[model samples]
Structures are given as C-alpha cells and as structure tokens.
Target chain A: MRTEAGPPVTVVVGAGLVGASIGHALTGAGWRVHLVDAVPSHAMVAAGLGAGTAEPAEPSEVGLVVVAVPPRTIADVVGESLQTYPYATVTDVGSVKAGVLDALWERPVDLTRYVGSHPMAGSHHSGPVTADGDLFVDRTWVVTPHRKSAEASTARVVELVRACRARLVTLDVDDHDAAVARVSHLPHLVSVLMAGHLTDVPEEDLVLAGQGLRDVTRIAGGDPGLWQQIVRANATAVLRELRQVAVSLDRLITAVETAPTDEAPADLSLSRELERGVDGTRRIPGKHGSAAVPYEQVVVAIPDEPGALARLFGDVEAAGVNVEDIAIEHDASRQVGYLTLSVQPERAEGLAVVMRDGGWTVV
Target chain B: MRTEAGPPVTVVVGAGLVGASIGHALTGAGWRVHLVDAVPSHAMVAAGLGAGTAEPAEPSEVGLVVVAVPPRTIADVVGESLQTYPYATVTDVGSVKAGVLDALWERPVDLTRYVGSHPMAGSHHSGPVTADGDLFVDRTWVVTPHRKSAEASTARVVELVRACRARLVTLDVDDHDAAVARVSHLPHLVSVLMAGHLTDVPEEDLVLAGQGLRDVTRIAGGDPGLWQQIVRANATAVLRELRQVAVSLDRLITAVETAPTDEAPADLSLSRELERGVDGTRRIPGKHGSAAVPYEQVVVAIPDEPGALARLFGDVEAAGVNVEDIAIEHDASRQVGYLTLSVQPERAEGLAVVMRDGGWTVV
Candidate 1:
C-alpha cells in the first residue's frame, strides 16, 4: 500500500450510487472530496448525505478524478475529466469497460493516465439515497488497465481501491466483460425470462408460488432502463452465453420428450446435464473465497413478536456456539417464523439441545 | 369443510420428504398413520422420527390411502392401493397430475375411488431425515379429481388437506399441469440452463458470484434424478413453456444486439420485457395471500461477537417497532455483519431514531 502523509484529495464526477458511495467511503477515510454532477440537485443530495462537498472539481490540486457515469456516456466524460484535470490520474466505474475503451480509442484522447475500474457491488435500488459508505467493503473491485495505461496510473487506481477497503482483482477489459457476462448479465436475463412467464399467469395459480420461484425471480425486480443499458453494452458476450443456454434448453426438451420407457434402458443424457448443473453450483465461492462448506441447520420456532428473536439469539449465544448464518422464514397465515441457524456441523446437535432445553422449540 | 369426531386414520406410502411430512402432520393431528415404503429402511427411519408407525396397512379399516411415490410409479401404486383398500379413498401426491391420471386411464382400475392431489411444498433435501411436520402448513395443495371420480372421494381428499393445515385449490388435471408447468417447471429448467453454463467456467470467474447469481441458481442444486423425472412426467406442458421461453430469449437477443445508437430512438421492446418482469414480480403474494406490500428496510452494523445480534434485536424491541423481516449479511473478510431489519413503512424512521440513540449504528 502507498502511504501518504495526509488524506488524498479526490474529485468525483456523477452523484449516482457508485460515485456517491465512493465519495462516502473516501470522506469517511479523511479525504478532501469534491462532488460534481450535471444534475445539481443530485450532487446536493449526495453532499447532504455526507458523501462529499458539492462543488466544482479543484483540477490543479486533485490527485485522482473518478468518473462514475453510465456506460453510454463514460468515454466522453472520462475524456473531458482527463483534459480538465491534467495532473490527476483518471478512472471510470462503468459496468462494461472494453466498449468504453474502444469509444475512447476513437477520440483523440490521452490514454496513459486512464484506468478502467468496476466495483462488483450494487443494490436493486438506484441513485444516491441507496448509497452506503460500506457498500464496497470486502467486495471485489476489478481494475482493467489498457495497454496504453501507465504503470503509475495503475498504481494510483490500486491505491484508490485500497482506500475504499475493497479487494482488488486485475483483468484486461475484454476478460472483465466476459467474466461479468457469465456471472451477472446472463443470470439477469434468465431471471427476466423466468419472471416474464408470470406476466400472463392467473392470480390463482401464482398464489401457489413457493420459495423456489421467489428465489429464481427476485433479481428480475431491478430497473429495466439501467439493465437494458448493461445488457446492450455487453451484448456480444451476453449473446454468446444466451445462445449456449438456448442450445442447452433445446437438448433438455429433447431429453424430457424422449425419456426412457418402463421397459427401455435409462438415458444418461438428462442425468449428465443435471450433474453438470450440480458441478456448476459447487464452483461458486462461499464467504471469503472459500469453497462452499456444508453447515448443519437448526430451525427454531419463534413468535412474530419483536423480542422473540432477541431472546432466541440470546439463548444461542449463551450456549457458546457461533452462528455462521441465519435465515428467517415466516409462515404468513400463522404469524410465526422459523429462524434457521447455520452452525458448524458438529455443534448443531449441541446447540439444538441447549436451545430446546431453554424452552425453545428446535426442529 | 368436512367435520369428524376424531382424527381419521391415514395410510401413507413412500416414506420420502413429502410422504413423511404428511405422516408427521397427520399423526400430530391425532391420526393413526401407517408408514410403508418399498425400501424398508426408509419406512423404519420415518417411524423412528415419529412420522408414523412402521406397519402393514390394515386395508379394511383404512379411511384414506396416500400414494407419495415418484411420478413414474404413481399410477401403478395408486391402482394397487385402490384395489387393496376398496372402501378407502385413494390420492396420490405427485408433482404432475395429468401424466398419472393418463396412466390410470389406460388401466382397468376404478377411477371413481381416486383423487389426484399435489401439495406444492418441497425442499432441496429428500427423504424422511429432512422431513418436517409443518412443511405443508400455509402451502397450497391442489386436488385434481378425475372426471369419473365420485364427490365422496374428493371430499375425503379435502379433509386430508385440512388435517395438514394446507390451503386447497381445485383445478382440472390439464389445468394443474399447465399451471405448474409455467410456475415450477419453467423456473427449474431456466435455473438448470443457467447453472450448466457454469460447468466449464473458470474458478476465477465463479469467485465473483454475488447474491444475484446465488438466488437465481439455488434451485439448480436439487437432485438431478428427481428433477429429470418431474420434467419428463410433465413433458408436454413443460415443453410448451420451454418453447415460449426460447422465443422470448431470441427476441431479447435481437433487442440487445440491435439496441438504439446514440442518435437513434430508444428501443421499446427491451424496456417492455423488463417492465413486464417488474409487473409480474409485483403480483406475487407477500404473506398470507395478501398483496405484495413494500416494507422499509433499515440496516444496522453489528459486531461478529456472540451477543452482538441479540443486543441489536433487543434494542429494536425496546424501541417497540415490530420487525417484519430480517436479513443478515456477513462480510466474511471483515468479520462484520449488517443486520437489515424490515419494518412497517410508517415506523422505520422512528425505529432508526431509537436504535441510533441507543448507541447502535443504523443506516
């Protein structure tokens, strides 16, 4: 990490969630931050929220200029920021980097001072009101340095990531787009397609929906205008994955249609695809980039009253067992909830016994 | 609703999750449930768990016979059960009703004695070990009686659902298959297709997975064999939905690829699909078959120590605000978690004020 005598002065362009959040984190870190936005009220709102001071950029004194504009306007804004703040290293926080870099390449702009970065953190809500100072903490922030980028510029971007307390991952622009296409863009569209089916469904049928349907379609509730831009920005990569899904879906349809008869031998193709699904799920990293570990879950019945959860947690804490994770499931009709606690496999039985003995219902 | 002086004795076949859960609920409701399975060990395990007694069915005295076998064997098993217990009403709790009914249509069995029912309740786990008596509570149980079925058989099935505290929805066999095909089968395949794309993904890319991908692909982690059976059993209905999805995916690809240029007008199709997704998600019942009410979420930063969550909940309770729901998000690297409490919209500000005044960080 680069050590400085005082907090670095940084200039933030755009007062959206990403930009505001970056300002909030840097301000809380003792940085002198200036926020500028085309929409004056947005900048004022972000400033009021303690993100930064709503003011023009101090071009000469600024050490870093961060552009957190939408994908379509990123290149133009980055070009202007670089020209205005000639002494400062400039970077952008756009979802797609390769397209922006290509757009910049078309302009007569200096590329050596620019590094493209994307903090892989977001919420369903948009704008600065949903901004949190700790949004990027412990989240991966991808830094994509073009071939023309200077070593010093790359170093400055890394320092900025460190100041925001985010894990740094280095990738080329193309590689970054492809990775997000698989992990983010593809899943997003899949959610949309699944949820779109519900558009014409009868209300009576939808009443039977369960947790499985809910989980699959939760992300479909995001803003369409923003997502359209994202999908369009990375169209090539996303289209590639979408075609792969189409082919897989076709094969599954065939497999289901030609499933084995009672007297015939079983077909391995269907099982093969499902096993592949299992394999893919296993590859997702759990907390802290670790393999997904299996935890024994102990479900405790708790009333819907406010103090019930507190009492249950107190009882669990008294047992000296650590709770790894928790999920609260409510039975709407009964107004009762099941608090599922995940703990070390060996400790589950002990924890359940303790909770049950303490007058709690453990299932 | 039908009323009886005492809880009716019900015999459950196939001691799996659904079967054993039914047994557990019925037994808890004062029913004498006999548990049987081709696999003797499964029945014995269900018996040990107090789901029911491991014994042969007393056909002459049985009031109801529930066939909870896999979809492929449901018809055959239901036929044998109806023949064995001539006086008892027979029902099979299979995921797909039409396929089972069609199979029975080809047999010489008495269709008037059978009722095809499906309880839309399941978990990722299978078998009796993961069974819970409360699984069916607040869940929808569909009863699709055949055209040749008598009213008495349907009434018995309705009483069974009432004993398990499940909501009842009656639909024709074809309608039930189509409804589940749209809601359950389509989502499952979509999850499978998305997850299959991850089969060959680089581990580095998979590490960037977030809650969005986790939620979208969660159902993909289920048993492949069981899912294959489910998809195949409802092939016609599932294939129809799958084909519709294929057309939708194609349109989405075209929309993304041909997105509006800077000088061109914005495309309406992409935005339309996304808007439809939003509308669909809005229609899902929030709790207790009520409209999806939006709750205000307040996030609190808590230490990872033993009593930190308990203390936070206690503080919230002391403020006298009811927590509608809670989601605990842990930043594993930092060992800190954000406990997000959802409350009534009108009470959020007051709750935040109280908690902040009590030395808690509320965001």
Candidate 2:
C-alpha cells in the first residue's frame, strides 16, 4: 500500500490529449508519471514529447491512477486501473460521470477508491500532438464523488486539480453530468445544427457572413466521433436540454410568423424572450472564471508594418495604465488593423489621449 | 439640380451608428455632408463628433442622400428624402432590403432614384458614440437594385460603398433578405434561444461554461429592441430557416432518446449530422471577405506587465514574418496572458524559434 510520505507517483492510462496533458504537467512537477495506452505508438509519442516514461520500472509504489480514455472505454479502463493499483486512489477524466459510475457498479472494482473528474478545458483539436501542460490553467475542474467514494480518494483528486493550476469544484456524480449537459453538450449540438444548415446555403450568399456566425458555428467543427461518444454517455441530460431549446425555438417561429408588416407595433412576447437572452448572456462569468466587470474599449488603428505593435505597446506602457484585455482585428483586404484595448472605464479617456498624442490613430 | 460637375456633397439622415459612421467616412473623404436626425440632439451630437454639419447652409446641388434610420422607419424617411432632394440618388442602409422596397411601392416616390444598401457591419453597441469612420472598412456592403432601379442610381450607391472602403456585392432586393435570414437573422435567433435557457440554470452550474458556450451565446446579449425590429423585417425568411432547424432538432431528440448504454455502438445518423456541421463550418469565408486560408498559431505566454508585449512583438518583427492575425487571451485570475499569433503555415516554426530564443515561453 502506498502512503502520503512516499514520493508522489501516478499511472496515467490512455495517452490522448487530456491524458498526455496531465502527464506533461505531473512530469513537470517532479511526479513519476507512468504513461500507458492501448496504442503503443500514442504512448511512445506522448513520452517522446516529455509527458512521461512509457516503461514501468516499478508498480507497487503508484500513489494514484488517472484514467483518461474515451467515454465508452472509461468504465473498463478505470476498472483495470483500480485492480492494478489496489492502494492508489482511482479517478477517470470522463465528460460524463454517472454513466461511468453506473457501469462500474456491475464490475468487481472498489468504488471507495474511485472518483470522477472532468477538466472543463475542451478543444476541437485532439491527440497527444496538441497536448500542453498549460491547458488546464485557470480552468474549472469538476470532481464528482458518488455515495461510496471515500473522502481520501476525493482529496487525492483535489491534489491533482491543484497541481494542474485549475480551480476546483466538487459536485455529485449525477449533478456533474447535468451541469455539462446544460453548459457544454447542449451548446455543442445547437452549434452543430446551425452549421449543418450552412451545408445547403449558396457559397455566394455566404459572403454576407459576419463574426457572429463565425463564433456561433466554430464548435461545430469539432470531431464528430468524439462528440458522438460524449453525448451518448450523457444522452438523457442532453435530450432534456435540447428539448427545452426546441420549445423556445417554436415560440420564436410563431412570433416571426405573426408579426405585422414593418412600421407597425408587434407583440411584446418576442421582445421578452430576447430580453431573457440578454440577461442570461450577462450572467456568464468573465474569462478565467473571474466575476464580470464592465470594460470600455479604446480602439486603435494600427498600421501593418514591422514594430508597429511594439511602438503601440510602448506608448500604452508610457501611459501607466494596464490594458485589461485586447482584441486584434485584421482582414486580408486591409493593411490597417483595429486593435481594441479593453481597460477600466475611468482610464479610457486618458489612455485615448495618450495614444492620440503618440501619433497613433485612436478611433 | 445637382450635376456630376459639382463638388461631392451628400445629406445623411438618422445620425445613428450607421449613418454617423457613413457621415464620418464621407466627411474624411472631403465631401460636404449634411447630417440630420429625427431627434435633433442625435444630429447635433454626431456633428459635434465631426460626422458632419448639423446645420445645412445650402440644400441645392446635393448629389446623394443616405437614409440610415430605424428599420421600421426606413421607408418613410427614405421616401421623404427622395422627395426632399429631387434628382439626387437615394439609398437606405436597412438590414432587410425587400421590406423597404415593398413598403415604397405604396408611396409616390420615383423608384429610379432609389436603391437598397445594407452595410453588413452590425454591432451590438449603437448610436453615434460607437460610430467610427473605419466601421465599414473591408466589410461587406450589399446593394440591392430592384427591377425598375436606374443604373445611374445603383452606380452612385456602389460609389458610396467604395468610399467607405467596403466590399460590394450587388444582388436582387428580395434575394438580399433571404440571404440575411439564413446567414444573419436565423443564427441570431438560435443564439438567443440557446442563451435564454441559461436563465433557468443554477448560477453555480454556469461555472462549467467554457469559451464555446460564451461564443455561442455572445450575440444573445445584443439589444432585444433592435433584434426584434430586424427579425420582424425578415420574418418570412427567418421563419423558413427556423422551421428547417426545428425539423433537424426533432431528429436529434429521437436519436438521443433511443441511444443505448455507453459501451454500445449507436446509430450513424447522429454522427452524419455532426459531420455535416464540420463540412459546413469549413465552408465559411475567412476574415475580411477573403477566402479561408490555413494558418498555424504560435502560442506565446505574455507576461501581464508593461513592455512585455513590446518585447514579444519586437522579437516577432525581427523574425521578418508578419503575423496574419493575433488573438489576445487574458484572464483576470492569471498574471500571464496567452497571445496566439496566427501566421502563414510555413512561417510558424521559424517564428516560434525566434520567440523561444528571445526567452519568451512558446507553448
């Protein structure tokens, strides 16, 4: 049996994007990471990228086991991990938790040592080639502990979240699934439905597309096979959320159909639904899970040339105000780019003046 | 009567975001602009910002008139403009083109001098304060010429689009409405519906929200009053798109309901729908009305201190490769920012090396 007094060591099963990223981070933190995968090449590739060692020179000293396989294979792989490392805390990084736990009940594995984890850092791109130690930085990592999950096992998983520099949120196994269905799975399917319709749109008419369409459809470009597995594992919750959206969509259709011709007042119901959306969107937390703050943007028209940004940044630094955030907008057709600096509202006026004095066009 | 021999002159009505922006651009181009608004203060404020002169010293010899009022009031304002400025080409920058033409048929205004122009630079922020001369730069500006519209008036509208540095796409008036429904209006309602569900979600569960949910719902935060007017103008086409999505959604619900446990392989139709989304997302044009080109991102961890970006951009500029685009990501929770620079595929490796050698963390 492993003890907390021993050197930290972990066995990471399945060297995919999530697994490899965890391996990379644990290795960097001086943990002995044993990277294993069904595909030997994937394990080798991940190890070559300095994620961990593929060779298991010793096994009895393993302190924790992390299962990072696909959703459908998570139950089997996690079961194997618990049996292989009997004394180690076991956890599976599956997007869906209840499905894995329910499947595990039929197997002869120790439920007390197993917990469920889902790192809310999803990317369309997959594989070990895209893995990074910083992927989970400031991200919310949910740890789901069922009724049988031991407090010791949950605490060990919390250690992993801290090591990854992620914020921790403990939830029930089933509650975790429901939250993801409302936030992630449902949004993914809606994005897919929107993009799928684009398949029938004429290429020329698509010239009218804007940033809104681009953003709304971006997630639809994710891997279909992987998403299929994810949604299947959490089918019930996803269906509930999807049906709710469908009801609202039907109401929108009716509103659009009944609206009188232009120049006449319409029913207030459509406006109310739209206002609800406005409120909901405002409820989302700001980037990095920070509370949302009101920011005013100071727009700068930057010339596309060598050291233009350098000059701009130097001038901004001279103003002694930190730019809270920035968005750089460029189009191939234009030589000038619009770089919007989001700063505290109180500082916007002074920053604009400072920028304008620097001979930079502050739009 | 105005002639081509006279100096460039135009009367801008509405003095809102679109109108003020047009006035701003035209004034910068050395044209004499007379800005007017239903609310006298709007024109006064817009003129104060150098959009144009609110006081019209002379009314004769006006070469063109741009009507940029609310969508519901466009036809009335535009008809009045044509009657007020005889022999001048008249155009309205409305989101829905066919509605305006449809409403105009009931009036006695000459159709020869009128054309429909929709500057596809819609922003959630409105009014003159949010207006800029560069708002229309490289944006798609659609000009809709009806069957009876004279070629000279269409040419004048085309020139206005060019003066604002926007790309021109001329289509039939009714076709313009259909295209916006599919590309703009429908996506908007989908975004709204998706966000509307967030109202019922527990605030704690919303912490699970990622960039995908935020992106998909960002447009939902737009002013409900403005969107109500827009969707109403293009109701028929918006209704058609929404019904089509509804049909696809019903199929999705059935697939979700019948799916078996996680370990089993399910139907292929769900996967096909997701794959179609992947294909459709790939079909959207790249930024700046350009064809989509494959670019690789060189991720740089920028410190949240002054002169950090200056040094980074300095190193990047020294590499002698221009960054095709840049996305600046900063979270208030972290002291470090991830600045992803999108460059041509061939230049990424060299740029990364340059950044790393300069002591910047290239992730």
Candidate 3:
C-alpha cells in the first residue's frame, strides 16, 4: 500500500455488484475503502466471502462516498449520504442520470462536493459475491457534472475513474440517460420481450432451442427487481428508443405482408429487407470493449458432452490467447459441434495453431 | 439395426439442416435413406458432416423426399423433384407454407404422394454444417395435408417425423406460417434491429462489452442469406406479428412519455399497460419448451479468471442438477464478479451445495 498518504479513505454504499466492485477497485488502488449497505450486516456478508469489508462509516473521516444502490432508491440514498456525511464529497453510479438529478433537485446539498457518474458497464450477474477489483479497467465511466458541481469534486470523480484504468466520457444528465437508453436500456427491454415469448412455450420444444435463442434471450434472465427499477427510472428515454425500434418493425411487417409470391421474379425484395435488418444489426461488438475493431472469429469443432467446452476454453487460456467472444453449435445427432471464438485479429493465427496443437480441431 | 424388417426408404431433398437431420434420423431408424441436393456436393458435405447423405438415388427408388430448403427456393426445388421422381412420396420442411403452397397451386402432381410439412425447429446456423439427426427430436413437426393428399402419403410423412422422435403438429399451410411468424420470425427481426445499432459504435467501446451485450446481440451474427429468404417467404405472417409487437411497443412509449413526475407517482394506469404487454409476452415458453415458469434467483460469488466458471459448472453438474440459465455480472470498479445461474425450484438447494462444496462462494 502507498504510505505517502495513509490511503485515500473511500466509501461505497450498497453491497451489490456495483458497490462491492467500487470498493474492491479502490482497495487495489491503495485506497482505504469502507463499504456501507442499507441492510445492517450486508457488508459483513460480503467481506467474509473475500469480496471486502466495510468499516463503520463516519461522516467526517471519509473523503468520498459512492452511492450504488438501485436506481429507484439512488436519490434518497445519495441525499441521505450527503446530509449524513457533510465533509465527504458525494457521487453516484446510477444507470439513469436525469432521474437522480431531478430527485436531488429539491434537496439542496453542498453541490460543490457532488458529481454524477455512471459507468456504461455491468454483468448480468449482480450483488457483492460478483464484485471484482478490476471490473472497470478499460471500461467507460460517464461523468455528468452539474454546473453547480465543484471543479474539485468533478476532478476527484475523474481521478476515481483513472484509478480504475477506465476511460472517461462526460455528458449531461439527460444526454447520458438518452445514450444509455439507446445502447443499454432499450436492448434490455427488447431482450426481455423476446425471452418472455419463451415463457409460454411447451417445455419439450425449448429443449430444441439453439445458440441463437440462448443468445437472444440471455438478458431475459436478469434480476427482475433491478430491471424493474431501471426501466421505470429511465422510462421516457427507453420508450423513445422502443418507438424507434417499433418503426423499423412496422416497416418490416408491411413489407412482409405485401411481399410478392415466391414464384414472382421480384419476390426477393422481402429477403432483401430482412438482410438489411441483419446487416444493420451486426455492428455490435461481441466481447471486445472496442467496437471499432471487430474481433476475428476462429471456429473450433468439438464433441458434445461434459467437460468439452471447459477443456476447449482451458486450452485457449493455456495458449495465452484471450477469447473475446465464443459461440457453440451442438446437435447430438452429429455428435460434433463447432465453437466459434472471437480473438484479437492479430492473435487469431497464433491462437489457432496453439489450439490445434493442444489436440483440438480448429475450423 | 433392427433386422425384423428393413424400414421404408426415405429420400430427403435440399440437404440443409432440417432436411439433413431428417435423413440422418431416418437412416438411424433402420431405413434405407436416399438424400439429394441440386448442388451435387451437398449430399457429400451433409453426410460427411454427419447431417445426412444419400445412397445413390435411382429414379423413384425412395419412399419419400423431404425437401428442406429456403422458403423462396423450396417451391421450385420441390416441384422439380416431384416431377423428376414421380413415385417417391414427398414433403417439405419450409418455414412459410403459404408460399410453397402457392407455388404449387396449379401444378399437376400426385397429391396423394405429397404432404407439406414444417418442423418448428432450427438454429441460428444454416446449411449442412448445422444439421443433426436429433434436431427434430421432441420438436413439433407440422404436417399440412392437402385435400387431395393421399392418406398413405400423410402417414408416411407422419412416420418420418415419428422416426425422428418429433411430435406431430397438424396444421394447414397458412396457420403454420402465422404461428411461426409470431414465435420465430418477429423475434429474429427484433434481435437484428437491436444488434445493428452497435455497428457504428467507436472501436473503443466495443471491447468493454460483457455477456449482456453478447447475449442480446448474438443472433445478429446469423447468416443474412438464410434470414432474408425466411422473412421473404413468410412475409405475411411475420408482418402480422410485427404489427402486434408494434402496437405493444407504441403503448409502452405512450405510457413512459406520459409518466407522472415526483408530484404524482408514476401513473398506475401506464404501469398496468406496460405490465399487460409484459404479461402477454411472458406467455411464451422458457427453457426445454416448457411453460414459462417464473423463477426466483440466488447469485453466487466467483473469482474473475480462467477455470472459475468451469469449476463452478463442474460442481453444479456433479450435483446432478440441471441449470436453467447462467449469467455473469462483472463490475468495472471491482476485480471480482458474480455468476447467477437459474435452476428448477427443486434443484436450487442442491446447486447451492454443489457450489459451496466446490469451494465457490454461493450467496
């Protein structure tokens, strides 16, 4: 630990994934971190599991307090924290920024010691057990500083992101919400709706589902409580994006309805439309944080059964290749399926050779 | 392998995933199967890849021809095959039945030997590579027998499905398209549109994506050619479902845009409207084709590195527990993260033990 200054005292509220994570990262950065959760024993539950521990918080002793509770409860928590810890600078890591801003509007606090921040990052998993110290590395952390926010406070938050090795994105509260609504919130809702379809399916039929269904409906399994709060909090912007999606869907429906008969020479138009939709959608990066450079895929063939996937990944790791994305295709009839791994373009050739040498089939 | 009597020969045309799977299954069922594909190499590829293959075709030598090809091309391929091999009973595995029916509208053929079929099973993958003998096992195989269709032909097709271990779903051409449009086509289009949004994202942000983004956008990587054909062939039904989804989306937008502020609690009416949409959508089945069963989750803490997930899964598997779903929550600020796995009600306790015994932190 850096002794130049007895570690910077950092405080995190909530023992959820976000809060625990912030605490872990700060501790790794030589910061003396204290965690606080609304539930009295929450911090202890987390700390005993090796995630980290929260020290009994005192208002004046902590230099910074981060509120990482659910969106619906963020404002109340932030406000209480600000009032309770008068000397500490306050910040929040909420999904929606404008909601927090609006909630804090009436509660006049020392604005100079507060800044609004959101990291455009998360896993589908949640809570303290999943918190990691390096989760923010190379991720985007948005800093929404109000005009009333003190420059020192803003810098402190920026420094917090830097300490975690995360990139900084600055935007106003509304813009941040809108952008997230487009990138994250809308996607969540769409996935939920899609997965909800499976809710009524006959149990036997779902067994036939392939990787596509698995991938498309993955987010549907998210924490309903957390999602309820997120969607409700960012309802306006999320719905706006939903409407945009609705427009495209409507157009697609219209085209499908009026499509020519299969015998007609020009009947390929609908196919073209569907193709357009697909082409438009592949712009998403699979695993790499950098969307600009798409990861290169190398498909590996493996047999179906236990330990097959585990061993394949083990080989990838053994070869010192980082797999950015992985897709598995398995059908028992063939007894063999292919696994597509997206690796850095520069590493693909080397990774393929190493994997093949490890007694795996690379396609 | 059953030597009591040789099963009737089955010839499957087109040799795609569905067609090949049917052939593979039939061959496995003691049937002398003959598979054909226009692209002369298709049979070889399909068989070599373990999807299916043909034992040299003699004119009218097989009992049935299962045409499994793209919707736009199915009609032409089936028509030609029907003419070329007049004695073979024939059926097709196309998504859009209406288009194929319309294509054969006035064609004079042995209707007694032909029954239209659509197996409501597929993968995001395409072609012979993804074909498997078990693809149709326990899945629904819709058989649309025409008015003039021979009872014997329908029986043969039904027998074909039975051999594949798939359940029978009887429906006419139009109804099948409409139902599938609702369940499959519309959802796929939605996935594409959402994934397409990230195409323009800068390279920097792409690398930061986690399992959530991957899950939501996975289907976006599907082959455009196959999807285009599907959307075009089943345009009418797809369009209908898209309209229904649009209505739901519109209502959601209205509710959110008009949401009450702090002065008034969010309008319960709007929330109800959104809930209705959610309820209607959730009627879809969950995993294993079962009815949508709402589950409560327990997240487990796990380390952030290689073999963590593997060890976790190995323990869960060793406990003889089936996992409904698995999700990983990664926090950028923390180096640790949690993995949330969905399991059946009866298996949750057992799974917790498996994790605990495996030295994992299950919360």
DockQ numbers for every candidate? 0.60, 0.63, 0.27
lDDT of 2 at A333: 50
Q: Lowest-scoring 10 consecutive residues by lDDT in candidate 2 chain A?
A: A121-130
Give the CA lDDT, 0 to 100, for residue A176 in model 2.
90
Please report how far candidate 1 places residue B332 from its true position, in Å: 7.1
The true-versus-predicted C-alpha distance at residue A244 of model 3, in Å, is 2.3
Ranking of candidates on TM-score, top first: 1, 2, 3
* lDDT accuracy of residue A326 in candidate 3: 49
lDDT of each: 0.83, 0.83, 0.67
Clash count per candidate: 0, 0, 54
Best by DockQ: 2
lDDT of 2 by residue, B1-363 (tens): 666663357999989888999999998888889999889999999999999999973546787899998888988988888888887889999899888888989788898999999987735433214578888887778899998899999999998998998888889877889899998888888899999999989988887777688879978888788898898888888888899999999988887777654675666778888898998898888766678877888878887776677678778888888877777765424446788788888898888888889988776
Error of 2 at A219 (Å): 1.6
Looking at model 3 chain B, which ten-residue stretch has the lowest summed lDDT? B1-10
Q: Second chain TM-score per prediction?
A: 0.91, 0.89, 0.84
What global local distance difference test value does model 1 have?
0.83
